[model samples]
Target: MSLSAATLRSLKHHNYRLWAGADLVSVTGTWMQVLGVNWLILSKTGSAASVGLSLVLQALPTLLLGLWGGALADRLPSRPVVLATQVAHAVLAAVLASVAMSDPASMTPVYGLVLASGVVSAIGGPALGRFGAEVVPREDLPNALALGSVINSGGRILGMSLAGMLLPFTGAGGLFLLNAVSFFAVIASILAMRASEMHRLVHAGENSGSVRAGLAYVLRTPRLLVLLALALVLGSLGRNYQVTMAAMSAGPLDAGAGGYGLLSTVFAIGTVAGGVIAAGRPRLTIGLLLGAALLTSVAQSVSGLMPGMAAFAALILPIAAGAVIIDTTVGTRVQLDSPGDMRGRVIAVQGVVSAAAGAVGGPLLGWLCDELGPRLTLEAAGAATVAATLVAAAALARLSNVRLDRAVLLPVRGILRRAPAEQAAALP
Candidate 1:
């Protein structure tokens, strides 16, 4: 298939274009703020562990309220839910900026504001995800998801790169204020969308399923259970490159902030390329997901052993690329596999998997980087991801006789592999 055609199929819609364009701008700023938050703690405490703790605090809200947020998204329209959350985010960011400006030396304001923003994000994240699905038809949904990854990764590239450059000039407070301003673009896009064109999902009633129902939904679906397992393991262990990368840049590479930004940009580039390839897939398969995971896990494991900064950056490209495949496959599969009424809840479940990863993995990994060194930390993460992939593949093979062992051994089998129509039904 022509990659351009497949990628553009969804972009042809005017509403998506408007929403996506504005989203690009807003997402870029959000990343800037993310780097800002992490950098601020590093500058103040000079501890990677503190940076990890901030990540935990950000994810903690999702553990507490993310499911409820997804339930609310299912019950209400995504636009208003998203709009309300965006406004909340803007207010919190502005407050952080103000506090940062007044008390540049204080740690209290940073933690407080981060926790507050996390609370809003818990609600907004699912609603925002569901909004992307609503803008395109069922056929275009996969493409939109892949393209969204591209946009998100692109934002990381621009945001982090710019943050590295601007941190010296504007500081963390400036990033917060800019993120606050960026929300207006998304708000305007929401207001501008033609509601008549949206393919909104039909609900059973004003109220659909609860958080418990969402958990039950995933528990019952074997595919989702397997995919969520992958997400938790890979997302938690394999993907906290930020901490290791920062440490590597500062310690081994001796490249400092500028070097860290360069590494991030390259990683984002890999995701963009991977998203494009994933966008071209007409249908996704467990074979593809497992294959992608294994491939990336291997890259990650090898990355830890690289001798120098140059080789390290090159190896990370493939690792980051494979991450996009795993991410897109899991996200697209979970969304399409579930019924419309269950969409929001399912998305929320994915969030739970992510939160669990950060809540547990972030601090653990950060501390390891301090004690064990960045190299060993990356190697350990890679080994865990590899173990998770093989375990998930084996589970499917035992239950469905799907023969994924061959898929894991032969990298090329993944591209050629197609799943059984019913995914060998009766998986628990």
Candidate 2:
């Protein structure tokens, strides 16, 4: 098969096609809502801190409920659970639109709606995370997830672009209204799916459904424990580029908002490109995951050393690409290795990682940027990620005898070569 064919093989399954297409629409609208809400907060309060707080409110639910959310994914039927969440999302969007339109002065209702939406996300995210197993076979899952990264990257670009163009005329309320409509796409798609065609995921047993059990599972599994540590470190330090990017624009680069926006656009392009390339991979391995992790962390360090804005922008492409590949690779490995009963909870830990990044890393990184400046701050983040990756490599080496070259380089070589689907290199 051609590379395009391989990348899109998951879409040949009827259910996944509908789900993915709808997800693209919903994701686009979700980004619009995000930009709209942030704009609304800033316009109302004229304080960047207030805007930051709004983000915290949106992510807080995941920290509080992520484990339970994953447990719910294991216990409940995805059709009903996903359907209900989509509808709740629609309602929340509509309410946000209403509040933005009717009472622009009241920040309380806006904050409340954001928190409620976060609650729904925290609960639904894990089910959504592992939903691909039901739609596509295990063999095609890696492609499905890589394609999802594409959808996400594309959606952010499209949604933010649309919101930027429409916001002046429609206001934040308009973007929210648009997002409200977008949810229907996913809801209808879910209802239309043929449940009979869905595959059963690998289940550990009835006794393995609790949140505590999920945590215990990760704690006991060497590969999983290493991955969890990698996620926390990489996610917190390596992935918080938004703050670092802005600081570079305003501080040493002195390029202002336009430069920040340009860098963001470039990063999005990189992710889209990376996701497309990653979609053609035949399998996910511990090797590919660690390689991508190393590439990302190391590239991050090199990017910090770039003296000019142009050089930095160029470097961010691989940084973003590596980040997406790492995400797709890690999520795929986690899902493949985990039993169905434990899958949601394991995936839900990713949410906890994200929340911790936002709560702990965001503030800490921000302080670093303020005190030490963006250049030094980026180096610190890069150093932190490099150290974490090395420690993880050492742990894996001890547990599984993972060799650096075989585990890291071979898979990356396969990726670069786009090895024939049947001939793709599979490494430890």
Candidate 3:
């Protein structure tokens, strides 16, 4: 399918609208909180490593706790799981805001609160991933997933931009307050959706044994293993974008927080665009995975090397686009291929891999920034990513009967039917 034509048809699902609306408001709060959190830490400690350390604290728990979260999701209904999580998140945000405002000198407690919030989010991640399948039909799953990506990245863009504006106005404390309010907005939206609208995925033999069984399934399936490997490699390398870009933009790039915000915004723009394109595509294939990885790596390399701001910004667009495409394709595939009961665990595994990346990547990049510089770190990582992509493609091609053409990712078999080619192409 042509890219232009595919965009329109992917948006017919009602679920996507609800998801997008909540996400639009919530994502901005997330971005604002992130920006404020970083600044708050930096101002208090006056150390780069502290900034990195805080992120490590926030993400490290996910590596340890994500699988458990997935297991819980499998045992429970996702609606209540998500709803409860949203409430917890909102309360955490409120606490952070109160602490930040009442005791400006006590940043340590704030970090503790952020760490607590991270743990809550780690548990919530799998539920959020599985929720898409519940809300939309199988046929619209990919599109819904893609639109989710668009909403997520679009939220990042607008949120970060607004963060840039709001942080200076209200200080980090005020931003936290606004973020707290936004969480309530998301919670309200989620509650407003009809219970009948949430359809649970009933996979064959969903009465499963242990989390190890899910792992066993992944291990037994060569394609799934390949996809997992791709996810691991991509997470390790791609996670460096934030640390590297932040350091470069603020230091050698001399762009400051605003520049960092601009860089992230460009990436967000690419993400939304990529999500749109992937939604319209016929199916997920090894070729698409390889292409996305290679394109992202190449774009990263170019962006890292470019000395001019405009050049770097332009390079970021393709990189962001590629990253989102890889994410959208892999994410949808994982959702479709897994059993409903085990889908939570599968998504949890993905989250754990990504969280593991954050745990390791942040400190590694920070140390690299201190020694070799951000550009060198980015260049090396980008090269490694491209190499990993090639290896993944080769392994995928070796499968005896898994032809790219035979793998139909669209219509999410046994799911809902979308409008034909005409409906797939329109935006909105």
Candidate 4:
């Protein structure tokens, strides 16, 4: 297939097209809110630690209930679950907008609203993943996932730029309201999709045991374990870009808000490029995932050492691209590898682990920024990610050796089948 055709294959499906459009809008709004909230906190408290606290509040729910949410997705129709979550998110956004308008001097209300939204996200995240899987044929899942990453990256670019432009006129309250409206776009699209056209899986029954089953499966699967391990390390140490980038721009670079926004835009451009490249790939593999993680970590480290804003901006391109490649490849692998009935649960497990990492890492990184400085913070995170990736590679190498031995034994077993049974046994 041509590059465009390969990258756009998932969009050929009517349902997937509708879903992608809705996702683009919703994700854009979400990114806007993220920037708005973080900026609002920084402006108020003038501390990266306060910004980190907000992120912790947003992620704590996922760490606590993400697995249960996944189990719920397995037991329920993804459409209704996703719809309910979207509605909840809209409501939360509206509440946040109202709070922002009220001009509370304290961070208490903002933290509470963020915590509530995080609760909804924890529950809806896995169901949303399953819903996306339903929209396209199995063969096109990787493409769909890559396209989803593209939307996420593109939305960040648009949202961050818009937030910067709008911050002066509308302030954070207006941005929150915009996000509230954006949720409806997704709700409408979900309503538009015909259930019959979706590649639905039967509900796995409403059993509490299902949650444990998902956890057990991940523990037992060597590849899944390795992937999750990599995610935990990278997510905790390196993925808190909102915190790191903000501090870097405002602190070390002395660039202020506009500069920070521009950096986000530059990074997002790289992510869009990475997503497009990932979409063109025919398949994903463990080796590819690990390699991407290593490259991303190395790039991040290099980005920290850049002497000027222009050079740092240039390095961020590869850093963001590498990160996107890792995310898309690992996400596609999770979807393709899991059993249909258990896919939601497996995804939830991943969400929980990642969220936990973020919760812990965000605060720690923020503190590091305060104590050591943004430059050292980025370098430390990159080093940690590199260490984690190497460990995962070593583990994967062991698994690869076992698989290779099995492959070699398979041909020997085949030769034995061609020989007389007694003679084959004697030769062995």
Candidate 5:
């Protein structure tokens, strides 16, 4: 397929197009709010620690209650669940805007609103995840997911750029108000979608133990276990780029804030490129995910040894690209492998693991940076990531009859075509 054709394939679906448009708006607004919040906290407290604490407050609820939310998603109608959450988000954004306008110096209400928004996100995430699949045909599901990532990366770049321009006049209050309006765009688009056209999956039946069922399912599935293990390690050790990059820019590179900003811009660009590349693929597989993870870790390790800022910056593009490929591939695999009824629960489980890794890894990596120096910290993290990938690959090879050699050599589509019926099913 031509590049445009490949990238635009998912947009052929009407529902997906609507969802994509709305999501782009929503994600852009979200990034603006993120930047506004960081700026506000820094200005008010003049403490980096305070800014970090605000982020932790936002992520904590998602880490703790995500699974229960997923279970709820499985039991309820996805549309209603999503609508409710979007409304909740809008209300919170409006409240935050009011507080910012009325009492800009008060940190307590701002923190409370951020925490509330996080709670709504934790509950809505799984439903929104499953809803995306419902909007597109099965063959287009991967493309839709890839496109979603593209929207996220593109929006972050756009929103951050716009925030820089808008913040001087509007203040954080204006940005919050803009985000509040963005939520309505999504709500309107969703309302416009044809319910009958959606490829609705069968809902998981109501059960008191539904959340536990998701946990049990993961424990029983070897492929899922391996996938999660790799995710845990990569997320915890390899993916704490904020900490590593900040330390590297300030300490070893002596590049300061400008260098950090440049690095972030480059990484975001690379991520957008990766998402477009992933959208072109016809299928995703375990081999692709593992290969991407291994490549990313290796590249990060090598980049840490670069002698100058320019050389390190050059290497960061591939590192960022590889990370995005790994994330998209793993997410696609999880959605594909899961049964319709259990998809929400499975996604929630993945979210929980990722959140937990971030919660733990951020502090650990920061400590490592202080103790071992930034360059050594990156090298150590890369080594840990490589070790985790190897262990996961070994277990997969033994449990699922996956040949590492073949997995490494074959294109995902070719590998699927060549495998025996039962072996293909068994191959992770």
Candidate 6:
């Protein structure tokens, strides 16, 4: 089906437009930093383990403190929180850039700076995520979510491509400097937004509950719990395929850093396509989630078995498509299903679940690659993702009365009728 005016109606909102533009710029810088860090570690230590360790430092804080961050989002204006985080990030990027420039190629202080930057990211991620819900009208939440994905996918392509090309001249230090500068673009956009125009659903000191309340609410709701479980499996363990993809390209494909960048770009192309498709659709559905998850698992498996560069690139398209579909669907559904006061905490819980998965999955997959080889490790991870999909599907199926798609698309429309009041009421 083609995108019609009704499907694209969400663009009419001014705030969403502002968010889309800012996120596009900011996320591109984040992607550049990611690539630069990976390269920096590889150059310094010549070990995959160091690469994994850096990733761990970057992500471990999220797994550990995401819930607290979520609570903080609920207690304050998300825009201000985001603004503060961006400022801190910019400073950190500048520091790293300085360190990189002085040495041209240093490891010790670079990794330490990366670790410090990750601590900042851990604070930023939940605030950034929940901020979307506050930036646009509730009716446009799904559209905003889709647009966020579009911006992120596009950013990955832009940043990774630019980093690959610029690294020769700027080195890791220069890229870090560029990343620091990019944050101002986002900061300016955010500051330009009218405070009255911000669509915040929760004001300060509104939802006062112990963190346990958030946990209890999530557990009491089977559907939300199921979705979070799937996110953990796919986002964390299944995504390890990406790490392996880089390794395989550098090894079997003999593609080097440029080749790895190409794989990222290819995957991002599919992600962009998928985000566009999702934006033009009505709302999320359970069937769509299942289909996407299964497709992602199978596609990932296929990626593992590809023989050469062309084949690998071709296989990654479907895998990336499935990945974006799942991300957009889950992201939209979580916002739609949550109560206004509890939105931040719910989103935070989701973040924690996802971070936990990545924390465990990244190192696990990295270790497996070290032991079993990239090809076998990726193939096994894909199979495991498929099994997770099956389990998620079976669990969701039991909620037969729950109209999964409608719950996501028109959350205000009464799909919650199928859900128990206690499921929502249990929120702390």
TM-score of 2: 0.95
Q: How well does each candidate superpose onto the true structure, as a TM-score?
A: 0.88, 0.95, 0.85, 0.85, 0.95, 0.84
**Candidate 3 Cα misplacement greater than 4 A, ranges:** 1-11, 203-209, 246-262, 302-307, 366-376, 400-428
* Candidate closer to the true structure by lDDT (higher is better), 2 or 3: 2
lDDT of 2: 0.84
Model 2, 122-151: lDDT tens digits are: 999988776766888888888999999999
Better candidate number, 1 or 3, judged by lDDT: 1
CA deviation > 4 Å runs, candidate 4: 39-49, 105-107, 206-209, 242-261, 367-380, 402-428
Q: Write the per-residue lDDT of candidate 6 for residues 1-428, one digit (tens) a residue.
A: 34566446666767667777877888888888888888887887899788878877777777777777777776777788988988999999999888767764557787788777777767676678777777778767776677677788899889988998999988988888888998998788887777787777764354464466667777888889888888989987676556787788867688999899788778778889777766665565555667667767877777778889999899888777767778887887787887766677788787777778777887788788788877787788889988897777767766655443432223222222423212321111
C-alpha lDDT values of all predictions: 0.82, 0.84, 0.74, 0.82, 0.85, 0.75
- State, as a TM-score between 0 and 1, how close model 1 is to the true structure: 0.88
Predicted candidate 5 versus true structure: per-residue lDDT over 268-340, tens digit per residue:
9889988887787666567767667777888888878987789888888878877787788888988998898
- The residue-level lDDT of candidate 3 at 312 comes to 82
- What tens digits encode model 4's per-residue C-alpha lDDT throughout 12-83? 999999999999999889989998899889988999889878888888888898999988999888998998
Off by over 4 Å in 1: 39-50, 168-171, 204-208, 246-261, 367-377, 398-401, 405-411, 414-428
Q: What's the lDDT for candidate 5?
A: 0.85
**Model 2 CA lDDT for position 401:** 66
* Candidate 6: regions farther than 4 A off: 1-8, 44-48, 104-108, 204-207, 247-262, 302-312, 367-379, 402-428
- Superposition TM-score, candidate 6 onto the true structure: 0.84
Task: State the RMSD for candidate 1.
Answer: 3.6
Model 1 per-residue lDDT tens digits across residues 1-428: 47578667788998899888988999999999999999888988999778877877888899888888888878788888899988998999899888777757768778888998888988888888888898999888878888888888888788878988998999889999999999999999888988899999865365346777777877988877988988899998877787778989998778899999889878888899888877777655566777788878878888888888899999889788888878897898889888988888888889888888866776688889899988888888888888999998888666676566454554335443533212412222
Task: Write out the backbone clash pairs for model 5.
Answer: none
lDDT winner, 4 or 6? 4
Instruction: Report how far residue 166 has shifted in candidate 6, in Å.
Output: 2.2
